[model samples]
Target: MRILTKFMLGLMLVLAVACSRTPTRAPSAGPGANPQLGDSRPHSWTSGSPYGQAVHGIDISRWQGNIDWNRVRGSGISFAFIKSTEGGDHVDPNFRRYWYEAAQARIPRGAYHYYYFCRSGFEQAQWFIRSVPREVGSMPPVIDLEWTNSKTCPRRPSPAEVKREASVFMDIVGRHYGQRPIIYTTVDFYRDNRLGDMRAEFWLRSVADHPRVRYPGQRWAFWQYTGTGIVPGIQGDVDLNAFAGSRSDWVRWLNTRLTR
Candidate 1:
C-alpha cells in the first residue's frame, strides 16, 4: 500500500510540473509587468527570478528623507504613492516636497492616508481632503487601513463599524478627487473587516509570498509586496508596490476612472 501511495504521489508531482511548463500566452512587451502600470515586465524583486513579469513601484513617507526624485525616476520606477495624512490632523512633513518632486521627475504619483481607528472617519477624510490637492494625472487616493499598535489610539472596531467608516471616508474622498478611492489593508485587517465585499479596488500588503498565493481569490489593484526595498535616491528601505496590469491599462485607468 505504501509503495503504491508513493508512486501515485510521484505521478501527481510529475503531472503538476508538466502542467506548469505548458505555454500560456505570448510574452507581453513587458511580460509580468504590472498590467495597471502598462509595463509587461516583472517587478524588480521577481524579474529574472522564479516570479517574472511584474511592473515595479514604491511608497514613501517622511522616513525616507530627502529623496532625489530624478534618480528614482531613472531607476525604472513606474509610480509612487506618497503618505499625505494621518488621523484628523497630522500630515507627513515630506508630503509636499515628495509630491512636487515626483511630479517634476514626471513620475505618476498618488497620495494615501493612514486611517486612525481612534478618530471618526469623517474627520480623517476632511483632513486628507484639505491636505492633498486635486491635480491632473494623479492616481486615485488610497486609504491605508491597518493596526497601528500605538499606545494612544488602539481601538479595534467591529467589522461592521470598520466597513461603515471606511465607506464614509472613501465616499467623501472619491467625490473630492473625482475617482473611486483604493483601500489598502493588511491581511488581518482585511479578514477582520470582511473587506472582500467592499466595492472599491484594493491595495493588499503581502511580503512573504505573492498576493495570489496568500490572498487566494481576492482581486487587488496594487500589491504592496515589500517594505525593505532598496531603491536609488532613497536613503534607506522603502515599501514597494505593483499595479495589477500593464502600462497601457494604467493609462486607461487614469483616463477613464481617475478624473471627474
Candidate 2:
C-alpha cells in the first residue's frame, strides 16, 4: 500500500510535466506518449528487480523517438510491440521500417493496430493484419484504445461505444492473428470501456501507480509502469515496461508458443 501510494504521488508530478513537454517520441507523436515531467526522478521504478530473467520489451509507434535495435539488443531487450496501423486507413509509416528492422535484428516482435472509435475496429485490425505479414517469429497483434485528440467532446466516443468498438477490433484481430491479441490501455480508458472482461493478454499503463497496483484482481502479462524512462539506443526518452512473471515464465511461454 505504501509503495503504491508513493507511485501515485509520482504520477501527479509526471502528468504536470508532460503537459508542456513536446511529445516528439511517442507512437503517434502527439498525446499518446507525452513525457511526464516534474517528478523527482524523471526515470525511476520500484520494481523488485527480476534478476535478468523476465522479458523486457517496448511498445513503439511513430512518435516514439529514434530507436537503435542493435543498441537495444545489447542491453538485454528480448521483444517489442511496434504500432502498425490506426483507425481503418491511417497506417503508421515507421512501423514498416521498425518491424522489419527488429526482425532482421533477430528479435521477437509483434505489431499493434490502434483502434479509432470513429472508424470500424474490424477494418483497422484487418489493415494491421494485412500490413504486418505473418513472419516466422511474431507476437500476436495488439489493440490500443485510448481517449484521443485532446479529449474533445464530440471526438471522444462514448464509453459504451468504445467498448463495442474494442470488441469488434479484438475479435477481428484475434481471428486473423491466430492468437489472442493483447489489449493496451490506461487505467482511465480501461475503466471507461470495462475492458477487464475482454479475454486477452493485457498491457496496462501505470507509470506511477505502482505499489498500489491500479488494475487489481486481473490477469496481466505486461505492466508499463514508467514513461519517464531514458534508455540507451532510443533517442531522447522512452517508456519502460516489465513482464509480470519470472524468467521461467518467459522461457516457458516462448518455448510453448514461439518455438514453432
Candidate 3:
C-alpha cells in the first residue's frame, strides 16, 4: 500500500511537471538520435535496448501537448501510438492533432484506448471506433489494460471475467478496424490476467529492464522500454518503444500484418 501510494504520488508529480512544460510556439529542429538519453547500462537489457538498430517509436497522450512530428521522425522514431479515447466518452483532446500531424510527417501511427474496468467493453469499443478513423498504413489499434485505482469504479473482477471482457472488447475493435488489436499491459497485469493465452499481439511495458529479461520467453510486438524518454520534438519526457526485429523485419511486419 505504501509503495502504491508513493508511485501514484510520483506519477501525479511527473504529470504536473510535464503538463506545465508544454511548448507554446512551433518546435524547432534539434538533435536527432542522442544515445546518452536512454538506458545505456551494460547488460542484457541494454543489449536489446530501443537505442539499437531496430525500429524505434513512442506513445503519446494529451500530456505530451503539441509535438513537432518532423523532429520526432528525424530522431529515429519510425512509428507512434497515440491515445485516442478512454472509457466510454473521454476523447483525448490531442488525438486529432497528433493523428493529422503524424500523417503529414509520414510517421506510421496507430490509436490506443485505455480500458476502463468500470465500463462495459462493448460501449468502450464503440467509443474508440467513433473517435479514431480507419486509415490505410496505420498500425494496428491497441487496448491498454491495467488497474484503474479509481475510487468511483474500483472493481477488479475475477480472472475469467477479465478475460471475457477483454475478448468482447478485442472482438469489437478487431471487427471495426479490420485488424487484430494489440494488447498493451503492465508486467503484473499481464501475468495476473493470463494475457499470454490471449490470441493477440502484445505491447509490453518494462522500464527498468528489457522485456526479454522481465517477461522471459514471452513474445512481444512492441516493447515500451522507458516512460521518461528525452526525444527532440517532445517538450517533456515521452515513452520510448522498440519493434521486436530489425529495420527490414519491422517494415515487413508493418506491411504484412497491418490491415487497411
Candidate 4:
C-alpha cells in the first residue's frame, strides 16, 4: 500500500508540473539597446525578486500632499488613479485641479468614483460622468466599492443590490468613456458584496500578498501591493501598485487603450 501511494504522489507531481504555464513575456532587447533591468541597469529598489516585473503606479486622494509633477517626472510612475467624487455629496475638493495637473505632466491618468451602498446606481454614475470629462487620452473610469459600516449613513446593501447598482453605474460610465471601466475593491469588501459576479476587470487592493488567497481563481489587472511605498515622485506615503503581468502585457494593454 505504501509503495502504491508513493507512485501515485509522484505521478500527481509530474502532472502538475506539466499542466502549469508561464506568464507572457516581452520581446528581447534589440541589437544596440539596453533594457531597464538588463546589463547596465538592473531593476533598482528590489531586495528579493518580485513574483513579476515591477510596473509601478499609484492611487491618490485629496488627503495626499500637494504634488509636484516635475519632481515625480522620472520616478517611474507609469500611471495614476485620482479620486474624483465620493458618495454623491462628498466630492474630493482637489480632484479637478490635481487630475488636470497629472494630465499636463504627460502622465497617463484615470479617475475613480466612490460607491455609496445606499445610493442609486444612476445617481453615482451621473456624478462620476459629470465630474470627469470624456477625453481621448484619459484612461477609463473606475468604480471603488469597499464596505465601511462606520460611514455616517451606512446602509449595508445585500450582495444582490450591490451587483445591480454596480452594473448600472458601470454601464453608464462605459457609455460615456467608450471603454469598460475598471472596478477597485478590497478583499473583504469584494467577498461580502460578491463582486466576483460582476463582469468588470479588477484593480484589487492587497497590500500584504497577492490576491490568490483572498480571491482564489480571480483575475486582477492591477494589484495595490504596498500602502507604504516611498517614491521620490510624490510627497507623503503613497499606495504603490503593480501591473498584473510582464512589461509586454502593458504594451498590449496600452496599444488597445491608448495608441501612443
Candidate 5:
C-alpha cells in the first residue's frame, strides 16, 4: 500500500513539472497571425521574426517599373509607400502613375521622399509637398533617411545637424499635409543619428533578423523584412514590410492615421 502511494505521488509530481514547462498555445487566427505571408528569398530566422505579423505591405520606386496595382492589391498587400521625390529638384518618374493606379485599386497608399544631404531640409520638404498631392484616405507621408555613397554629395553631417534638418523637414511637411510624417531608416543611420529621440513613428529595415534585434527597444510601426520579395504585380524583387499589429489593429490605424 505504501509503495503504491509513493508511485502515485511521484507520477503526480512529474505531471505537474511537465505542465509547468509546456507553453500555452497562441490563438491561431488572432493578432499577429498571418497565413498569407510569403517571400522570394526567405531567411532562416531563429527568433524575433516579423513574418508572424498580420498586416503586410510593400514600398516601391521607379525601379519596380510598370506595376499592376490590381494584382498587387489581390496579393494580400494592405498598404503601399510610393517613392515621390528625392533631393530638392528630382522627382520619381513613376510616382504619378503608381499613385493614381494604387488609388484606383483602392489600396491605402502614401508617398516617401529620400533625404538629400546636399540640400536644406526646407527645400526638400517643399519639393516633396510639390510632388505629392494631399488627398483624403491617403496614408501619412514618409521621409527616408540613410547614408549614401554619392560622389556628388558625400556629406555626413553630425547627429545634431541631422536631427535639426529632420525636424525642419518633418515640421514643414507635417503642417502642409495635415498629418504627421513617418520616418523610414536603416539600422546604421538610426543608430548614428539617435533617431529614437525623435517624435515620429519609425519604419525600420532589418532583413536578417527582426527590428527588435537591430534597433533594440526602439518603437517602430513598420518593419522592412526582405528586399527580394516576390509579389504578383511587381516585375522584379521588391521590398516587403509588415505592420506591427493585427488586422483589426490595422483597420483602427487606417481610420485614425489617414489624412483627413
Candidate 6:
C-alpha cells in the first residue's frame, strides 16, 4: 500500500510539473505577420521596426516589368505608388498599364514624379500633370527627389535652391490635382537639401533602419524599408513600403488624403 501511495504521489508530482511548464505557442499570424513579404537583403531591425505596422505597400516602375496585380493584391499589398513621369518629358513606359491594372485589382494607387535637377520644377510639374490624369479616388501625387551620379545631368543644387524647386513643383502639382504632393526622398538627399524644413508629407527611404532613426524629428507617411523585396507577382526584386499607421489609421488616411 505504501509503494502504491509513493507511485501515485510521484505521478501527481510529474503531472504538476507538466502543468507548470509553459506550453510552446505557435507564432502569431496577426496584422504585420505576413509571410509573403520576403526580402532578398533583409535587415535585422531593432527599434522602430516597420514590420509591426499593419499597412504595407509597394512602389513600382518599368523595372518591375509586367506585374500580376491580382497576385500582388492577394499577397497583402494594401497600396501602390506607380512611377509616372521623370524629368520634364520622360514618362515611365509602364505607368498607364500599371495604373489600370492596379485599379482593376482594387488597390489604391498613386503616381510619383522623379524630379530631375536639370529641369525647372515648373517644367517637371507640367510634365507630370500632363502624363497623369486628375482622377478622383486616386492617391496624391508624389515628388521623388534624389541626387544621382548620372553622367548627363549631375547638378547638385544648394539647399536653398532645392527647397525653392521642390516648393514650386509641389505647389503646381497640388493645384492641378487638388491634393497635396508627398515628397519621396533618400537620407542623403533629405539631409543635403534640408527637406525636414519643408511643410509636406514625406515618403522616406530607409532600408537599414526606421525612418525615425534616419530622418530624426521628421513625420513620414510611408517608409520604403527594402528595395530587394520579393513580392508574389513581381518578376525580380521590388521596393516594399510600410504606411506609418494601423489598419484603421490607414483607412482614415486614405479617406482624407486621396485626391477628390
Backbone clash numbers for all candidates listed: 29, 7, 0, 0, 0, 0
lDDT of 1: 0.74
> 120-145 in candidate 2: lDDT tens per residue?
66677677777877653467777887
lDDT of 4 by residue, 1-260 (tens): 44334433543343344246443454333211112212122223233232244355778998777887645545656678899988666779889877777766666678888888767999989888878877665667899989866547578888898888889999988888888889999989988877887898899987555577668888988877666655565666677677776545664575456411
Quality of model 4 by C-alpha lDDT: 0.69
Question: Which digits, one per residue and each the tens of the lDDT, describe model 6 over residues 30-148?
Answer: 32336676787777887667777776889999999989988997787888999999899799999999987877676788999988899999999989989998876688999999997
The candidate that wins on TM-score is: 6
What TM-score does model 4 achieve against the real structure?
0.78
lDDT to native, each model: 0.74, 0.63, 0.76, 0.69, 0.82, 0.83
The model with the greater TM-score, 1 or 4, is 1
Per-candidate TM equals 0.80, 0.75, 0.82, 0.78, 0.86, 0.87
lDDT of 1 by residue, 33-55 (tens): 32222222224434222123334
Ranking by lDDT: 6, 5, 3, 1, 4, 2
Error of 4 at 191 (Å): 1.3
Better of 2 and 4 by TM-score: 4
The collision pairs in model 3 are none
For candidate 6, which ten residues in a row score worst on lDDT? 23-32
lDDT of 2: 0.63
Model 3 residue 208 distance off true place after TM-score fit, in angstroms: 1.4
